[model samples]
Target: MTTDPAARSAPRSSARRRNLLLVSVLALVPWSVQTFTAGSATLLFPWGLVGPATGSVTTITDFFLRFTMGLPDYILVWPVGVACYLVALGSALSGVLFGREDVRLTAAGLLLAGVTQLEVARGFSVQPGRTAWPVGTVLLWAVAGFLYWSRAGERDAR
Candidate 1:
């Protein structure tokens, strides 16, 4: 049996695209949860200015209020979630369209994740029990960074 180089590479390319799509979808889960829970004032999303208004206004106002008021206890989870979602979407699209990873997208993801983690830790200091959820987000970013660094190292070696 004879095999062509293109045929050999096709499967690997498809697998990579599938992996990217999977990761992107998985990353959206937290964003969805965050968006839905943004109206809760007592539980996870407790950073409301006027006691959790209806709709996305609560998220928008809370984010701006927290930003301007220098309130470290209120980590803007919604914005962070949005950032995560955007980065994941961008990465998935780039993988599908370009057939390669986008370095800028990866870097943006890492930055957003790191900033979110820092904000979460700050919130944890004030509300130690309620802010632990973002640890998963931090870990995700850490894993992504590790993977990117390892892959870069391998490419450099070649």
Candidate 2:
């Protein structure tokens, strides 16, 4: 039996959407980690901050504080985790939007991911979680780069 035109195109379109979703999830991973990390700093949550602050399990904040790394002291003055989370959130949205016919959005996503990685690294340097950020950043960068490359390939194929 011959495949209908819609059937043929549907798989491709669905594949693209799935890929975009996967990329979005990857971008969200760091944000989720950062958010939980930030939430444990205090029982009271910041009004401007996103993510749940109650009953946090693991956070860079707690880690640094427990380890006496002197990094938590610096972080005490700034919402470093919140900033990272926002950056990651932005990147995730950009990844999803990049699947659309917008080149600018994809660039924005790449920039967001890069900036977020930098911010996370800075937090790590200042605190005790330097090791974690590198792993997460590398994963994020690899995924982001792959998604960008695939999109470029699709464009070139057209």
Candidate 3:
């Protein structure tokens, strides 16, 4: 009985690419939610879990205003959000193109998670919804960590 190395490795490569794509999408969720909810009360209900079916326009607007005002203008800048989105997108692209995972992806994920934590801590007093960002950021970090750890294990096994 014999086995071909390429045949054995092909499935693993495909699985890795799929995992990276999934992680990239997961990482984008927070940014998408934040971007959509900005200046729009209708989007707030799902993202921030605020407002109700019968909620008045004033009520929704008030919540949106409060949430927006809670964060610093610098943090809310469109460029900053776009940059973060790009980083996540790049990480996914790198994972797909480069079979060998790099430490930078894990570092970037951890850095984003840390920043989100700081934002939550500083802004939670003003906007409770800010806490949700950490959930997505942490999930991104977890996936990156898992990928990094699994790769290391594979090297050891080899």
**Best TM-score among the predictions, by candidate number:** 3
The local distance difference test score of model 3 is: 0.49
Scored against the true structure, residue 119 in model 3 reaches a CA lDDT of: 54
Candidate 2: the clashing residue pairs are 37-59
Q: What is the lDDT of residue 63 in candidate 1?
A: 59
Q: Is candidate 1 or candidate 3 better by lDDT?
A: 1
TM-score-sorted candidate list, best first = 3, 1, 2
Give the per-residue lDDT of model 2 (tens digit) for 1-158: 44698776665566456555655565344431242343343221211223344544444455545754555443442344344434544554544555343433443454455545555445645544322234445555565567567768876975
| TM-score-superior candidate, 2 or 3 | 3
Candidate 3 to native Cα RMSD, angstroms: 7.5
Cand. 1 Cα-lDDT: 0.52
lDDT of 1 by residue, 14-33 (tens): 75576466455444333212
Q: Per-candidate TM vs. native?
A: 0.52, 0.47, 0.53
Which of the numbered candidates is closest to the native, going by highest lDDT?
1
Clashes of each: 0, 1, 0
Q: Please give the distance, in angstroms, between residue 69's alpha carbon in candidate 3 and its true position after superposition.
A: 10
Each model's RMSD to truth, in Å? Answer: 6.7, 8.7, 7.5
